[model samples]
Target: MSTDTNTVTALPMRPVVADVLREAADADPRLVVLGADGQALAAGVRERYPERYIDVGIAEANLVGVASGLARAGRRVVVCAMAPFLVRRAAEQIRNDVANPGLDVTFVGVGGGLSYGTLGPTHHCPEDLGFFSALPHTRVYCPADVVDAAWAVRQALAVPGPAYVRLGARADRVVHAPDERFDAGTGLLMRPPGRALAVAAGAGVGIALDAADRLAGPGHTLGVLALTAVTPFPQERVRELAAGVDAVVVVEEHLASSGLGAATALALAGQWHGAFAAHSVHTGYPPIGDREELLAHYRITAGDVAASVLDAVRGPGAGARR
Candidate 1:
């Protein structure tokens, strides 16, 4: 909350995650960077925290396994590796070794989802959210931008259990986190006091914010959620906020079923008591294609997410229907 609401400032450093790691290392001596040698992000952490950083070469499973072991031995380990390789390649180690048994490991998933959009299907880690969401006692973090990405790392480090953090390949425009909105599971309401709302998860927050900027009105709101950690969702807060909004549209960069929409449905089913209608259109994905194609194909862009909000307000067959 140190920064002002409207003032957007860049991090003092170029790559902000480095500062985050350094801060965590300073905060706790037991913090270790468990990384694969090939990762640029991992290499950066290794250069600075040589003593506390371990480069385990190319073993994604070993990357997570070592972290689980470290956590068991009372050390806090951040397993940094390629997004898809770390999550998909190390599925068994993550599921069985950490998530299933509820081990205290944090997988720092780099280049998640379309961040590696051009890297092909094999490199995409869109399922990380779905993977962690279903796991028992597992927490998930999908940061909106670099600031929240760094904050997410801190949040996971503080937790004494398994956490998954998925970050984009490169820096994203900063999303303001003035107060407790940046806290674990809590979401930030970017636009204040509006009848209609667009809910966003991860980088989709930026898209929602952009749409809100263009859609000027007294009754239009943009509710962006960083979701630095999920599982112990900000249920009471979400329920309270969702109840008052006229229209609610959920957005995420993952498959619709297991991502933001699913979580929002569960939150509502547990008596959300929201103004939004029961029927809604999700940012769905089933076709195997590039991220842009996937988002456009699924109508998940800022304009599309925004259009859905207006559609929800007008109903199934309103004059404004497109």
Candidate 2:
């Protein structure tokens, strides 16, 4: 099955933090943005409110510590950095300083998963979702588009406690219409109700949408569910969305062992008894390659997702061609 070109607008996911932060900072004087080797993440806001923005260099642990201190001083703090360093290097500080006391600090992690492309395994952050989900008083978000990215930032800043929002390196195809009503832990329906459901998060949502289109003409009605929130997993919403679907497939860019695939399976464990499949990145270090090449290599493309759904819903040989 060939992937169809998405006609929707592609929004720059990383720059969205600057736009949302600028707006949020204008209203709240207590807001501060911290960057750890991530100047691009604070583009717009840093220009307007230079005083409110601080570049902490490449020290990831120090970045979290400073943000936590600011939050303790009655200020809204947001730390922007690369996912791997932010989640891995600063794990101790994040757990002890930010998450432990339940401080209101929102961490924006760009170049999530394999988005760093040829940057290799050292930069890849497929384990971020698992780390954040396991932390107490921490929320996780993997926005698929600009709208969802903005909403995630706003929601993260508005709520209490620490939060993580993951973003890819390049632009993302718009998954939601402009100004679509979205809330945390709720799956957004991208297609009409169908017997087969395709649930995806982050970049996988766009691939899932294309897969749904590919399965349309062959008497296959596949419903697409786009989820931005991972931690605080929406068990009730998954149960509601999987109402009549005979089979469900989860697609994600992260590892199958710790990402959305695991979260969805844990949610639907005993509640729903039906065919289920998860298409995610394989365990171990990914081969060095560009983003598109890595995605195809891992078999997480539109064709791969469509084929898996077909096999789950219609048995083994149904998706042979795909």
What RMSD, rounded to one decimal, does every model reach? 4.9, 3.4
For candidate 1, write residues 1-322 as lDDT tens digits: 2122255444321266666777777787888888787545555556667888888989888888887888788887778887788877788888888888777677777777666665666776667888887888888888867667777777887877888888777555566653434656456666653655565777666666766765666555555544555556676766667666656677667765777767777777757433442122243434666656655655667777667667655565332312
Instruction: Please tell me which predicted candidate would have the highest lDDT against the true structure.
Output: 2
Query: Which residue pairs collide in model 1, if any?
Result: none
Per-model lDDT: 0.67, 0.84
Instruction: Give the range where candidate 1 is weakest over 10 consecutive residues by summed lDDT.
Output: 277-286
Off by over 4 Å in 1: 1-14, 43-45, 177-181, 218-226, 270-294, 316-322
Candidate 2, lDDT over the whole model: 0.84
Question: Which regions of candidate 2 fall more than 4 Å away from where they truly are?
Answer: 1-3, 6-8, 316-322
Pairing residues by index, what is the TM-score of model 1? 0.83
Residue pairs with colliding backbones in model 2 are none
lDDT of 2 by residue, 1-322 (tens): 2246635677788777788888989989988899986788788778998998999999999999999899999999989999989999999999999998999999999888888889888888888888888788999998988888988888888888899999887777777777788767576877764767888899888888888988886456788888888778888878788767777888888887888888788878887767788878887557889987888888888898888777777875443323
| Predicted structure with the largest TM-score when compared to the true one | 2
